[model samples]
Structures are given as C-alpha cells and as structure tokens.
Target: MPPHARSRIESDLPGDQAAGKPAPQQPAWPDPGLLDEVQRELLNRPALVPAEESAHLADLMAAVARREAVALQGGDCAELFEDAAPSPVHRKLEQLYDLSATLREQLGMPVVTMGRMAGQYAKPRSSDWEHTPGGEVLAVYRGDAVNAAEADAAARVPDARRLLAAHDCAAATLKVIRESWQGRADGNRVFAAHELLLLPYELPQVRADPEPYASSLHFGWIGDRTREPDGAHVALAASVRNPVGVKVGPSTTAADLVRLARILNPERRPGRLTFIARMGADRIDPLLPPLVEAVSATGIPVAWISDPMHGNTTKTGRGRKTRSVQAILDELTAFVRILRAHGAWPGGLHLEMTPEPVTECVARSADARTAALNQYRSPCDPRLNAEQAADVVDAFVALLRAA
Candidate 1:
C-alpha cells in the first residue's frame, strides 16, 4: 500500500479512551476493487507510481525531515524555490513541488503545499469620480493601511491610492514598449494588452468604477477555500456590478450559485465563469463524478483546485504545529492528478505568504508562541518579503513554462 494511503487509514482509526492510545490493529488496506472505485471518481487519477519517481519522492521527504538544503526567509511560500534548479518531475507537479523542495532545503523542514488559485481581493468602491494626482493617491493609500486593523483591512478602500500608485508606476515602466509596438497594427493589441495585464492586482479599485474602464478591464476574486465568511464576497458584490468571471468549488450546487450570481448581475448575464472542485486524498470515492457534472451544468468553465496539504490535515482537532510532513506530500499529489484530468493547468498560484518569515501563523515559531494566535491578537502579517516573493514568482513562471 502507498505510504499516503497507510497514513490515511491511521488517521481515521479510532483512538483508545482509557489508555489514550490509538487502536492497536492496522486497518485493512483498501482492496483492488476499492482502489478502482476511488480512482474512478477523480477526473484523472495518476497511474500507479513509477518506481523512479516514487523512490525520489521518498528521498525528498527524508531529506526534508533531516533538514538538508531548505532555507526559510520571510515572504510568499513559492519564493522558497526561486533559486533552486527544479527536476523534470518538479515541473509536472507545478509550483507545489518546487515550493516543497525549497522549504525542505531552506527551513530544514517540510512545508505544506496547496494548489494554485488565480484571482485577487476585490478593491473597495471609490467615492470620488475624477482621477487624483499622485501625491493625493499616496496619502490615501498610506492612510488606508495605517487605519486597517485586520489582515485584509487595507482591502476595504474602494479607491485604494496604494494600488493606484503601483498600477501607475508599472504602467509607466511598460509605456515605452507599449508605444513602440503601437504602429504594428495586428500586434499592437498585444502590446496594449500587455500594458493592461501588468497590473492584474489592481481590481478592487477598478471595480469601483467599471464603466470608465469597462472596455479594458477584467476581474476575479480569491479567498481561502476553508476560510468561511470571506470579506471578498461583500467587496465583490459592491464592485462587480456586472457578470465577470467567478471561480468557486465543485461541490457547490448549481441552483444556489446561479441564484447568487443573478442577484449580483441583475441587468446582464455573467460570462466566462470558472468553478474549482476540491478533491483531496481522503474523500470517499462515490461523490466525484456527480460533483463535476453538477458544476459543469451551470455553463461555466470548471477547474479543480485540489487541496493536497489542507485536505487531509483538517481533522477534528488538529493544529498547524502537529501536521505531518508525509501528509502534505500525499495531498499535493492528489491535487496534481485532479487538475491534469480537469483540463486547466495550474495557471497561477496563491499562498498565505508574508514579508517576515517568523510570524504568528506558525505556532512553533517564536513570534506566535510569545504573542498568541487569537483572532484579535494574530501575530505580524504573513506576507512574503522581496526575496521570498521573487522566489514564488520564479517558481510559478517555471511551472508555467514547463506546462
């Protein structure tokens, strides 16, 4: 039996009440028939592992446990892989494995890897109509961050000056290239498109006035799959005045989502929708196909964002500190197979990164132990710093090129 499968069985076994020991006997590994049932539900389950990759993956895990080449700095999770040369198989795994390898090398520990998501937090709607000068925008941007009391507090500003400044600067940097190609009619659109696409993160502010920029704008939203009551939902409703692309889960029933979409886009129909289905290693086998079909019936482009790390780790009472290294690997592999079968490449990735590495999110870290991880007292932000952010970007670019 696969080590991951064995781990799943162990996790599910009942615990002893008196001695506080886990059940003594090993549960029977799923029979061949049971394995088929499980694979059938997944879009494209990987063939039984090749001997070479299996051995390599095991070696990688062991190296992580021993704290070999891994390094840990403060920044996005993907940044860890920026400097490393990825193996051919690492490309197939996309950002997850590259990141895993990086974490193992740098942190002397195994890092949990989740699937990619493509979207941004919605910008709050702006109250003003006219374009303001650069100085005014900078002041407003700084003020918003200073006043925000939550991890995403700055996300509330409808007309965020900070984002605008970034967008303007990026646009200016790309202007010469854009203008140079303007005379090439057929390819001019591509150059113009490049200018617009350079700042995909500027949506929340753009959505505040979709009409002025409607011809050149596109928007999407991102949030933690397991983190309920997302602030993005409210911000999206306020900013997404028309039907834009929406990426959601597969298990989400059709009728409910359509109704919600209708409410959000009352005057015009939304287009180019995408929904992500989460298929992890531990889910029961019978529910996969219907879940896929249900989401497909909504007439949207459906993709799967498999939660390799978080899926199995979310047990009844588990904490981040107690998560196992092997568990993270199993979940990540499951995610890769699911995405390959579903047709969408892991186009872009998202992670809970921070500028500083030793934040409160990791309980074993000093900051969290000293400060506390309570709602109001959550430690310093968990965003990736410059080097870390660059690493993640490099990893994603490598994965994209490999694909």
Candidate 2:
C-alpha cells in the first residue's frame, strides 16, 4: 500500500461498531503470500480512473441531493469477463443513454448516467457454499472477481490471479466505453460504477494523487451485506473522497443509518454520501419513512436513491431467480411518494439490468412470463430486459410528473 493510504485504513470512523464481525462475504483465500504479491503488483499499476473524474461524479451526486438533477445507475448484476468485448459494452451504454434521455425529458433535470461496469465482477453472496444438483457441495459463485460461476469443486477455489485479470478486464471495458462514447456531450456520457467488494482487489486500487479515491471505478458503493460501520468496506468508503453510497435494507435502523452518515460524511457534505433504499414494496411504507425522517433530521445532505430490483427479487417455480416488474414498479412508486412526502428528493434509481431480451423477469400487468430456463444467461441475479426497463422508467416519470 502507498504510504499515504495507511492512515485511511487504520483510522476508525466515529460511532463505528465493534470490529468483532468478520467482513462478510469475503472469499477465504488459500494462499496469503500469493495474495500479497497480487496486491503489490496492483499497487504499481496505473489506476483505472482519475481523481478528477471521481470528483466530478461527486458533484453530480450532490445535485441529486439538492433536487437539481436525478441519477440513473444500472447495468449487469455481475459483469462477465467475456462480455468485455465492444459489442456487449456498447449495447449496455446505448441502453443507459436511451433511459437517460427519457428521464431528462420528463424530469426536466440533467440525469447523471452511470453503469455497473468495469469493476462489478465481485459480489457479496448470502452463503459461502451451495449444493449442486448431484448432491455435491461446493463453494458459491461469488462473482467473476472471486471464483468461477461453474459448479465444480476445483473451479470454486479462490484465486488471487483472478484479481489481475479483473483489473485488465476493467481497463479494456473502460477503453471501449471511452472510445465509443468519444465526442458525446458530457450530459449524456455514462460513468462506470460497482460495489467495492473484494478487499484484495479494492485495497490495492486506492490512490491519493492529491485526494484519496478508488481509482478502479468512477463510483463505488458498499453493499447491504458489507456496510458494517466498522467493517473494511465502510472504512474504504470513509477513507476516500469519491462520492460513495450504501445499500439500505429493511433491517437497518434509523440510528444505525445516522451513525453511518456521520462516519461517511462527517462534514455533512452533499455528494459525499447516498443512501440507496432497497426496501421491498410491502416494507417501503412502514420501513423507509422512518429512515428518511431520521436521516433528514440530521441536516446531512444525502441523495436517497431507490433500488427496486434487489428488494423485489423472487424465484420461479423451477427455481430460477427472477423479479416481478409490477413489484419493482410498486416499490419504486412507494419509494418516490415516501421521499417526496418527507420533503426529500427521490434522487435516483439503481437497477440490475441488461439490454438484451432475456426473460429473467415477469410482468404480470403485461402478461409477461418468467424467463425461459433454456434462454436465461446471467451468472448471478436476474436482470430486467430493455423493454421492462423502459416500462419502469416510464412509470416512474409519470408518477414524478403527477407529484
């Protein structure tokens, strides 16, 4: 690690919880020496993003806090290394642009466009092991950054070498995004973001050219599973100057949220913090209001974005992971109404989506069926298709307009 980076990691944020809990969902790597070598190599490599771009993203997020703009951030639930090709990258970018255009026209505010790309290869899994169909027990597929999604014992071992590959893939994807998006107006350009999981990969990528920030991604966030106030993930976010967010789930208490806010944004800065509420449709009315009320009372400027996808996730009869479009829309509607009622800006929407026509999601209102088992492709969570995504944005805008 760089000399300047030590203080950021060692220092504890105010009101930090007991450091007893191990950082959840971290892969149990077998070789500590190999991991150290990987980290050293990463320290010598060029950062994937610049400090200035991250600062600019912070400014945009601040606008969302002020109700001067909105943010539309979505992409693959877990990016595949093979999908780093120009075709897949370009398709995703085009989809984001299409969504942003609609949001800008209806909301009459500049929509900050961000994609879960470049470094979204790692994920926090609910379990460390999964049972295969043949009754074989193996490690769960965390993400491409940790282990292979294939259900094999050998493939499940955590490998430090994959971190290097992830970095390379991130660089390639960024290259494609910049080349394809060159000459586009900044207002329509997309930014790269991902959950800052996988400490081995994330720790080495932190840089302090003058201000500390995660140079591996334009925007990075702490997942619901890893947002412990004293956990390494929160420490990483608190130590950086880039705009950071935390996934707010139903179980999170208002007091815990307040402590998180103080730890992350001690200065009460606007763009420095965002709380993405992933409360389910049924829980939003009862669960979200208190969080909003408590956080807002602190006078800390935070952008409250709704993540309608994660909270609404369900499984089909065949055991395939899927989500209901109606449920997603319902949660989004409740999210907006609740935020506005509290005199707060809805701020943005965070979704897991793809530009393809996959049937991983069902739309009961439209008579859409569950994803065909043979055609489903995502390695992790199901994602909304382009058509469903349009429906979500359209519904959200209609409600926003009325409100």
Every model's TM-score: 0.34, 0.93
Poorest lDDT segment (10 consecutive residues) of candidate 2: 1-10
Error of 2 at 84 (Å): 0.8
lDDT of 1 by residue, 1-403 (tens): 1121121111111111111222111112225344333323221222111223222322332232232322111122221211112331133233334454554454333342322111111112122121233322211111221113122423323232323333333233223323333453321111111111112122222311213121122223332231112222323332333223233443444454554344434443322222232344455133344444454454433223332222332311223222222333343344434444544333223333432333223322223324432332212223332244445445433433344
Q: How well does model 2 score by local distance difference test?
A: 0.85
The Cα local distance difference test for each model comes to 0.29, 0.85
TM-score winner among the candidates? 2
Residue 86 of model 2 has an lDDT of 88
In model 2, how large is the Cα lDDT of residue 160?
84
Candidate 1 lDDT at 366 equals: 28
Task: Kindly give the stretch of ten consecutive residues in candidate 1 with the minimal lDDT sum.
Answer: 187-196
Residue 104 C-alpha lDDT in model 1 = 42
Q: Per-residue alpha-carbon lDDT of model 2 for 1-403, expressed as tens digits?
A: 1011111232122222222334666777777689778978888899999999888888888888889999999999999999988899999999999999999998888998899999999888776777776889788888888789988888888888999999999999999888856888766679999998777788777788786778899888898988878777887788888899999998999998999999999998888898999988888899999999999899998998999999887776666778889999999999999999999999889999999988788875233334454558899998999998999989888988989
The whole-model C-alpha lDDT of candidate 1 against the native structure comes to 0.29
Q: Of the candidates shown, which would achieve the greatest lDDT relative to the real structure? A: 2
